[model samples]
Target: MVDVYLFSGFLGSGKTSLLLNVISQIKESGRKPAVFMNEFGSLSIDSDAVENGVPLKEVLDGCICCTGSEQTEAQIQSLLEENKDIDVILIETTGAAHPVEALDAIYSPIFADQLNIRGIITVVDSKLWLDRSRLSPQIRALYMEQIRHAHLLLANKSDLLTESEMATVSMELANYNEAAPVVQTIGAKIAFSYIEKVLHSTKEKSDTSIISGKGLPLSSKLITFTESVSRDDFEEWVKSLPETVYRMKGYVPLEGSINPHLFQYAYGMVSWLPEYVKMTPRLVIIGEGIDSIKYE
Candidate 1:
């Protein structure tokens, strides 16, 4: 049986970073592993971060928990058929995906018997979790469910918190998920030994509680802008966005630049990748109250 490892988390929780690390360790052990990435929006920049040698497959523009289930299953079946020699598979789900729905998709009659679930690891942003007051009730519930159903919970970005804050975050996460052990790490840098033990151990299977009903309602908005933006203007606009806006990503040509720059804004934090030409330049902003954000 091929072992399937699923990694889940909220936006900017470092799922890709953790997946890359896990892939490297699996490769070192002489096991053949394949990667499956699910993106919430159409344009994806995460798949490019994977190492050159790892086999990568991507599902874009939808959440794997809902309309993307059939597509996800198809991808898995195809992956197995083409790479029959692979010993393991790694699936990195979108931040908004509910693990229960993903669990159901993976355990369908088509794959339940052929694949053994090695583990479901959910990465949580310690700082984000600490300051979730602005999040909608539905979003909060979704986030809690992701942590509750995981086989392991990683409270990443620990360096952002003080010692007292770290303890508080740990305690709250413990309250949310007593079933899964919480591991703290800086920059999602967790040792493979701990991960290996969790994946290979003979612990009891996770409870598939099916807590998410009617799937997740689309509570966020996705806005796109095609106009070339000024770097200073863009930065200022991003800084002025309301707290309701959670994540923004896209490529846009900056003033006085020949190539477009990739911009990512997560919870008021902004990062710009080196200028490069990739796809049509446009921005996708996802969050509540997106209309309130003025992009001049």
Candidate 2:
């Protein structure tokens, strides 16, 4: 069975540069890799990036973040049909396509049973990553999910980081995922042997109970509520929260919980699937400023 590797990162994070390096390695190893790039609202800039003889199967449409599940599947299937013996696939997702959700869309029932979902790699731009504060936690959650689920992560653009800064980033990453290897590279120029060394473990079956629902077009607003009480009383109050909250999750220590508890409400839906850690739970309600709390 052929493998599919998804290489993604935020905008200007050297995804094309890294992909070129990997494709070159695949060529030298007497293997063929079909390349797919979904550059949202643009085209692939492969002039300086491609040096190898490997033919790239380019798809320069918008990011497959939401649509194109069937089209993306068809593109891959067509490649396989053209080259029935191709060794692997390398898909470079557009920066806007939250990498995990993009992968989920690909692995839907339509395509999930066909291809082996090999890996998802995210490259972080060290210089500007920390300053990205457009709903930092939400963005970071997506980034961290990519890192947490990856078999390998190449922290490309190492030149931007000092030795000390690299150490700090490494430490921070380790807190969440020490199992995956973190490689430092410049312009994603890591050696081929490093990538080929590990037989990437197969992806765990994705767990997204909420993804199947059609997300209503919501004009999201942020409202915050803070409370202080014993952990027991705090949790009791949390369970009784008005259902207008749409995805409120953060860590604020309550008076009694030994650890910080995180809570979330997906608008009208109620889910306690994610195990809650003990912490002060502050709720950020995302709903209309209007009184829409009666729906529940």
Candidate 3:
């Protein structure tokens, strides 16, 4: 059976950075690793940031916990078929995803005997969490859902908080999720040995039944445009996007540019960079109640 690792956390919680470190550790131990990335938006920002040479399968424009489940399952099947010798498959889910749904999607009857779930690692931002009380109830529910199903919770960015504050954060997380063990670190740096130990111990405690929830109504929209727009106009449009649109990403061609820029937006953050691979402009927006036609 192939070992599967699902990394879940809130947006901008350092999942990508920690994943890079984990992948490096796995490679040093002479294990072949494959990655499945879930992006809340359509653009492929985090996939590009991943170090070169790792085989990548991406599910874009939706969270794997909900709307993107079928595609994620298919991608996992494809990855296993293509990389017959891979030792482990690491799945990085969207920040807004629920681990319960993620587990459901990947736990297919066809792959029952072939796949073994290692554990779900949830990353937390100590700094941002200090103000979690002021966040909207919807966001707080999403955050709790991600952690409640974790096998290990990584309270990252501990350098930003004092020892007492760190303890408080850990205690709070424990209140929401008592099943998982909490490990605090700065910059999401964790020793590989500790991670392996956590995986083994969590597996010992896991039950045969999958976790279930009422389920969130997450949706996605993919839009393609044959025509290219000016860089200035594109930037302006991105800045004016609605908050209901949790994430948006895609490649966009400029009127006079040779290569199109890959754009990604999450929460209130927006970024655009020239993509190495040139492709037609295609935007994907994932969230609740998004009107794709309005953007077109």
In candidate 1, stretches whose alpha carbon ends up further than 4 angstroms from where it belongs are 204-296
In model 1, which residue pairs have backbone atoms overlapping below 3 Å? Answer: none
Model 2 spans > 4 angstroms off: 46-53, 108-114, 130-141, 199-296
Selected candidate, larger TM-score, 1 vs 3: 3
TM-score of each: 0.67, 0.61, 0.68
TM-score, predicted candidate 1 vs. hidden true structure: 0.67
lDDT comparison, 1 vs 2, better candidate: 1
Q: Model 3, which residues run further than 4 Å from truth?
A: 202-296
Top TM-score model:
3
Residue 35 miss distance in model 3 (angstroms): 0.4
Candidate 1, residues 1-296, lDDT tens digits: the string is 78777899999999999988888888898998889899988987899888886677778998887878778888888888888788888899999998756754554433444566666888999998988877899998888878876767899999999999999999998887665678998877777778767556533222221111111111122233456677888787777777756556656678777777777666667888876545446555444334334455
Error of 1 at 126 (Å): 0.1
